[model samples]
Target: MISMSPLLRLALLALVASITGWLGGRCRADVGDFAPCLPVFYRCWPPKGLAGTPICQRFGNQYRFATMYSRQRRSPWFSGYLYTVPTGRRPEPQLAYAEADGNMVPFPPGPLDQKVLDSQAVEPDYINSTYSRGHLNPSLHHRDHEDRTSTFTLTNAVPQKIGSNDGPWEVLEQTVNRTLGEYCLGEAYVVTGVIPYQKDERWLRDHRVAVPEYLWTAYCCPDYNNSLPKELREAFPTYAAIGRNDPNSTEEIVPVNQTAKTQFRGYDVRRMTLDTLETYLKDRFTTAVSVFYERCSGS
Candidate 1:
C-alpha cells in the first residue's frame, strides 16, 4: 500500500479541481459579446464570458470598459461584421472609438461574490494600479456592423497610458482600419491587445500608460483582389512597423519603460489562423484560462 502525505494529497486534489473548473468554464456556443461574427450580423455582447470576463457582465454591447477586454489584453471587446452595406443605408450611431459614453450599466456592485469576483478582477500579470485602460485593437478598426458590434466585450482590454491611448495609439488604430478598408477582401480577424507593463511602472497615477510604443497587427485575406494587384494572392503579406505620435520620444524603439517613454517600438506582424490565435492567447493567459479565471498570469 502506498502512503501519501496529507499535504500532498490536498495539493493534488486542488490541482484536479482547478482543471475541472476550467473545463467547466469553457465557452458554450461562443455566446455573449465574444461570439464570432457569422457572415453579416450585428449584435451586442456575446452570451457570457465568451467575450472575455472583465466587463462583459457590466453592459452588453452599448458601451465598452477601458482596460477590461474581450480576450487579448488592452484591446477592445472586438465584435465586428463582414458584410456589405447598401447605398443610402443607415447604421445607428454609437459612442466614439476612443471615448467612453460616461454611462455605467448595472451589475452587482461592491466586491463581486467570490465566484463572480474570480471572473471579474483583472489579471495581475498585466493588471496595474494606476494605468488607464488602453486599447490595442481599436474600435475604429471594426467599421462594418459585424466587427463593430463585437468590440464591447471586456476581454479585449488592458492598462494603458492616456498619452498612448490619445496619441500614437490612435494613429496606429486609424491606419489599420483605413488601410484594411482600402485593401484586403474576405474576412479579417484582428486580435490586438496591450503588452503587459514592465517593472518600472510607465503609467502615472490618475494618468494613462502608453501601450505598445509600436502596435503589432496580423491579418489574412483569402480573397484579396478587389483593391491591390492580383499578384498579391489570397494570403496577403502582413505588415508591422514602428510609429511615434510624440516628437520628443526616442527614434530607437524598444519595450516601454515604467518611468520613461520610448520614441520607437518594434512591431511584429504575420498571417495567422484562428486556431493559432487561440493557442497564442492560451499561452499568454496561462493555464486553462477564460475571462473568469482567478489566476493572474501577468509577469
Candidate 2:
C-alpha cells in the first residue's frame, strides 16, 4: 500500500478516491496521510505522536486496515484496524514477497527495492532467522476472507520471538477476541505497535530488520453491553497490554514468570491502563504517543 512522484501521486490519489473496484481485484495506493482510509479508525481518529510512513492497506481493491511503517528499521511502527467477531480456523499467512512498488512475481531477491524501502527485502532478511513474522494486526482479529488475508502483508509485520508470539501473547489475543465477541455491541478499533529497546537494540542475523523488545496492543469499544462482570468492568471502553519479546530483558516493564510452563515462562504479557501503556510508549519514543482519542472516552 505506497511511493511515487508528488504530482503523479496526487493525481493517483484523486483517481483512486473516485474509482471503486470489486473486492476480488487489486488497487493499492501509499498515501502521505490517512485522509482516504479514516473508516479504519475509531471515531475516524488515528493515533497521534508516532512518526512513520502511512500505508492504506488496500487489498482486493478495498481498504481493510492501516499500517505505519518504518523505513530505517524495516518494520511496522504500528497497525490500526477495526475488529469483528472472527469465524472459522486461522488460515496460512499469504506472505507478499513483492517489492513495495509492485509485486515481484517469483520475487527474485536480487532486485533492489524502492518506496517501502527494505533494500535488503523482507523475505531474505528472515531466512533462517531466529524470529517469527509477528503480525501487528493479526488474522485472529478479523472475520472476512479478504480481511484475514489482508493482514498477511509484510508491511504489517515485525520481528518477534517465538516465546512471545506463541505464548502468553497468543493467549492475550484470544482473551481479547472472547471479550470483544461477547461484550462489544458495536465496532471495535484496535491499534498494535512495538517498543524497541532504547539501548543496545537487537537485530536479526542479517541486521536487515530490527527486533522489538516489546509488543503493545490496545482496543477501543465505546458501545457495549452494560452487564459486564465485575472483574471485567474496567476493560472498556479501552484496555491495553505490553508483551515481553526478550526473555533476558529486565522485569521493570513486564516481569517474567519464572515458575510458568517451559515454553511460556519468560515471555509475560502485562495488562494495564491505556495511559500506562502510552506512558511507556512516550518514554521509549521520547515523545507523547497516544493510542486512542481522549483515551477512548465513551461519552
Candidate 3:
C-alpha cells in the first residue's frame, strides 16, 4: 500500500469533517452562522427546517451547558448537555438568559432585550399559559449544581402540557438516567427534540410559542457492557422514543390508553428502535430526520 502525503491526509480530514460534522470526537458547534460554543464533549445533530441559535449557558461567569434554540417557536428545538446521575437533591429552578454573540453583561433575573440574542422566550410568555415550561435538557440529568442550574433557561424550554411534562414524560427522563447510569460503559450522546404538526399547527396561549404535537428523544451509546439483561438485549447500542404531547393526536404513532388515570390518559410514550423512530419523523417532517450518524455505530 502506498503512503499518503501529509498535505493529502489533511485535505481528506477536512472533507470528512465537512460531510459528517464530526471533529475531534465532538460534533461541530457551528450550525448555520451560529456558534453554540458547546463544551468539548457535547455533540450536536442540527435538524432541518429551523434556524438554530447556539446558547452557551453561563452563570456567575462560568460556562455550564449549551443549547440550540429556535426563534420561530420561541423555544428550544433541542438542547445538548452531558448526562450524569445526580448525587444530591436537585437544584432549585432558576431561569436565566444568554446574550448570544451580543454583550458580555451578566444574566439578570428579570426581562431581557430580545433583539440582542437572536430572540429568546421570556418568563411572561408562560405565566398564564396552560402549559408548563418544560426543559429539553432536564436538571436531573446532571450531577453538578451549576450544570443542573444551567438547564433552567427559557431558551432551553418549550410549552409542554402538565399531563405530559409531569407525568409519562418525566418518567421517561428518569428511566433514561437509570438505564444509562447502569448499562452504558462510556459516554452516551443524547438528542431530545420536538415534532410539529403537518398542518394546522398549535400555539401557546400567548400565540408567540409553538407547541409541539410530539416529543422525541434518542440516545447513542457506542460503548456498553456486553453482559446484558434478557429484556435489554436490543437497548444497548441505541434506542429512541416518541411521546404524545397532544391528547387528540392520532393513535397511529402512539396508542392512547383509555384506562390510564385522568392526568396521564392521552399522553403515552412509545419506545422503539432508532430506525422505527426515524420512519415516523420522516413521515411527519416530509424529509429524512437523521438523529445520529450511522445510528452511532461502533465496530
Candidate 4:
C-alpha cells in the first residue's frame, strides 16, 4: 500500500481530533453564543440567539462552505460562503439533506424525522407548497462545480415566496456577481439570512419548516478596486439588503410597489449600507444583529 503524505496525515489527525472533541460531550441546544468552526477562508459574523447546529458543508469529502442551521425551524438562519467569479457553467440542481456527523443515515430523498437530527427539511417540504426553496448562499457566487453543487442542500434553504425568489432578489444576486467579479480584487465573504415575524410565525404546508418574513444579506469585501463608478459607491468594504417575502406585510421597511407587474409586485429589495441594515435588524429582532466585526474596516 502507498504511504500517506505528511500533510495528509496531519489533516486526518486534525479531523479525527475535532470529531472526537465534538462527540465527547453532550450537544448543547441552547443559544450559548458559541462560535462555530468556519472554513479556513471564511469570516465569522454569527448572530445572537441563533440556537442551531453549525454545519461545515462537506461535499465530496471537502469543505465547501459554512451554515448555521436551526433544527427548530428546519431551515438555515444564515449561510456564509466565499464569493468568486464564475468560471464554469452552472451545475444542475441536485438537492440533498445534510447528514450531520453521521446523525442522519440512510440518506435519501424522503421525509425527515425530528428524532434523528431534530427535523431537517427535505424535498417533500417544498412539494406543492406556495413557497420556493430559496438558497441563502446562492450557487452563482462560487467558481468550482462542487462548490456550486454543494449549495443545493436543503439545510441552506428557506421557504421563500416565488415573487421574491425570481424577481428583485434574483436581480440583486446577479448584480452582486457582476460588481464583485469586476471590482473586487480579493475574496468576498457573503452572509445571507432571514428575519422572522414580530409576533405570528409562518410555516410551510406541512408546518415542518418555518417561513421567513424577510431575507437579509450582507457582504464583506476587504480588498477592492478603488476606482468605482459613482453609482456603485458604498458597495465596497460592506453592503446589505432586505427583501420582502410577504406582500401583505407593512411598508415601513421595504415598501411595496403597486404599479409593478402583478407577479413581481411587493417583492421589492431595499439595499443600504451595513450600519443601516443592522439598525433594521436590531429593531426587528429586538437585539443587535451584527453581521461583521467593525463593519470590516481597517484603520
Best by lDDT: 2
**Root-mean-square deviation of Cα positions for candidate 2 versus the true structure, in angstroms:** 7.1
Best by TM-score: 2
User: Each candidate's root-mean-square deviation in Å?
Assistant: 13.7, 7.1, 5.6, 7.1
| lDDT (0 to 1) per candidate | 0.37, 0.81, 0.75, 0.79
Candidate 2 clashing pairs, residues 3+ apart or interchain: 2-30
Q: Candidate 2 on 11-53: residue-level lDDT in tens? A: 9877766653331122232223875576677656678888988
Candidate with better lDDT, 1 vs 4: 4
lDDT for 226 (candidate 2)? 92
Assess candidate 2 and give its lDDT: 0.81
Taking the tens digit of each residue's C-alpha lDDT, what string does model 4 give over 1-299? 87999999999999978854653332222323233334222334444445577777777777677778888889988888889887788887767654655222234645546564456887767899899989998999998998888888888899999999999899999999999999899878888999888878999855689999999998888889999999888898889999999998899999887898899899999999998998988898787777765677632
List the candidate 4 regions with Cα displacement exceeding 4 Å: 1-49, 100-118
lDDT tens per residue, model 3, 189-295: 77788888878888865467889999888888778889989988898788889999999999999999898889998999999999998899888877787766566
lDDT string, candidate 1, 101-203, tens digits = 4233223335534542333323332455534444344446554453344433334444544565565555666655665665656544343443332333343
Candidate 1 vs. true structure, TM-score: 0.42
Worst 10 residues of 2 by lDDT: 22-31
Please report how far candidate 2 places residue 102 from its true position, in Å.
7.3
Candidate 1 regions exceeding 4 Å error are: 1-116, 121-130, 144-150, 197-215, 226-235, 241-299
